[model samples]
Target: MFEYISSLWSQFLSLLSSFNISSALDVLLVSFIIFSGIKLIRETRAEQLVKGIILLLGIWIVANIFSMNMMKTILSYFFNFSVIALLIIFQPEIRRALEQMGRNNFGKKLGLLNKEEEKQKEKKQRCISAVVDSAAYLQERKTGALMVIERETKLGDIINTGTVVDAIPSQQLICNIFFNKAPLHDGAMVIRDGMVYAAGCILPLTKSNKVSLELGTRHRAAIGMSENSDAVIVIVSEETGQISMALNGVLTRNYTRETLQNALEEYLSSSSEPKTQKKIPSFRKAKKS
Candidate 1:
């Protein structure tokens, strides 16, 4: 056994010495492919299938070493067929991986793309300003309103429940929706990709103990929806005529128009940094009278 091991090591060294740069690169590329495949399998239920394949390969290796011709031939065919079978079985995951690769490439090129993004962001800021201004105006007139601002997470599920508007946001349009007898006044309005996507949308209601009793259904619903998503919700109280904002399940109350505008700008600015800082004071943590 020792002599056999020494002979195998000598043969391996001889093969290594004979390898060209192209062969070395091919080996490195294959190593990376194997590593990535293992990682992908580990991340998904496909690991079980991989284990089965590995076991089959191991059996084949042992069979070939032992001169079991029939077993070697059968296993080789199974192994060859598995490559095509895996492509079909993991099609969705493969597509997602390719999409993620494309997104990463796009992100790397973002410096060149940022000018266009900035223009779109400028447009969005104007829309946000309009929404905030509309909410403030509505608050003064005691017009109840619910405005949902989309973030990283898609609000497609919520948007599907409401009437699709797809209109450019304006103060007049928002005010009209929440007017005394507007048909869509009863439900929330959803904004997505700088457009009002839907109206009269029913949002989930928040059940946070931290939420104040002074807050009505609109505020609770706003907090609820925001908690479930990465959305920013602006609520105008019909009874108290106050402006409030809800994010990540927390509500901030008594926002002046300027404060609201600044909060939106700070939160919505195109910075890629993760937001850990609170944009507004928590309603529960307000100073005692």
Candidate 2:
């Protein structure tokens, strides 16, 4: 046994010695590919399927070594067809992975240049101003309104629940929607890409224990929607005529027009701004409250 192992070790050393720089590089590249592929499949639903495939391959290797013809033949046939089967089973995840890779590449190409970032900041300010003005108008008129601003996460599913208007956002349009006699008075409005995408959209209600009883269904819905997506929700109470804002499931109440505008700018702005600017006034002081 010692002599046999010595011979095998000698053969391995000889093979290694014969490998040139290109051959060594090829081995390294292949190893990296396998390692990355394994890592990508791990912790996913694909992991179990991959394990099954590996188990079958192991069994086939053992069968071949033992000269078990039938077992080897069956395993080989299953292995031959597994490529198509795996693709079918993991299609969605595969597509998502590819899409993520494409986005990463695209984002790298866009390289956060200062000018482009400044333009985005400007656009966000415009949107914030529009929303704040609308909220102030609605609060004064006692017009109940729910406005959701989309953030990082896509609100495609939520947006589908409402009518798709895709109109340019304005204070007048928003106030009209929540007016006493308007058809969409009861439903929430969704804003995306600085546009009012839809109105009369129903939002989910929050079930959190931390929510205050002072909040109505509209406020609760705003909080609920924010909890699910990174959306900013502005609520104008119909009964109290107070303006409030919700983000990350937390509701801040009694926002004055000036404070509301500053808060919107602060929250929506991509760059660092003064923290003091975001502070909202006490709700109790507001006449609407």
Candidate 3:
């Protein structure tokens, strides 16, 4: 045992002596790429698929170690064509990652704000106020509502799924759209560039098991939409009158009128105006799904 340990130590020291700056840089780059790929698949269905693939790989290794010819052959054939299979299974995740890479954040990075940009900021501020007011009204009456505010990623495809109503947002208009008796109340409303771009739009449902089962279709849809794009989704419960927001696959709840406005402004505004770092309370209670 001591001789074996000495041999392993000698090999380790030899490996360390051979390592250089280029090897260090190569290792770092590979590590960063792996980390980025994992982060890209983190909260989506792809995460589970990845785990399944890793398990299969481990089993294949074990089969090889045991010289199980039949098992090794089957696993080898599966892995031989795994590249194409993986592409088909991960198509949505790949598309979303590419879109995120190409998303237009250059202006924000360069801090460029022209006259038209300033006007757009004003419009978004007004829209935020109207949305908060309508959410407050709906929460009081226990009327369910789902409003999606588009950000860097364009939601043109999603907007096409619903009836277009390109009008400036207003508290009364928003409330009427989500009224229980209204025709569009059952679907989602898409707010684009400070205007009500569409209503009655259908959103993809979340497939993640991480979400609480108590959440309803609206909350799941909100989380799903957030997972697919860089949008902020506001939801008001029909039964409990609780307000919630879904962003980047995380749902935060218990937002009052003032805090809701503050949160929206912090997310949507591009102005240089300083704002308070008010902490919006998180999801405090279990919700129905």
Please identify model 2 stretches exceeding 4 Å from their true place: 1-110, 113-119, 271-289
The model with the greater lDDT, 1 or 2, is 1
TM-score of each: 0.58, 0.56, 0.82
Model 3 ranges off by over 4 Å:
1-25, 41-47, 270-289
What is the model-wide C-alpha lDDT for candidate 3?
0.85
- What do the candidate models score in CA lDDT, each in turn? 0.77, 0.74, 0.85
Compose the digit string of candidate 3's lDDT tens values, residues 6-117: 9999999999999999999999999998998888777567888999999999999999999989999999999999999999999988877776677655667687778998
Q: Write the per-residue lDDT of candidate 2 for residues 169-241, one digit (tens) a residue.
A: 7788888888879888778888887788888888988755555676678888987776555577888999988
lDDT of 1 by residue, 211-276 (tens): 677778998899878656668898888998888888755677778877888778776664342355
Q: Rank the candidates by TM-score, best first.
A: 3, 1, 2
Judged by TM-score, which candidate is best?
3
True-structure Cα RMSD, model 1: 9.8
Residue-level error in angstroms, candidate 1, position 180 = 2.1
By lDDT, the better pick of 1 and 3 is 3
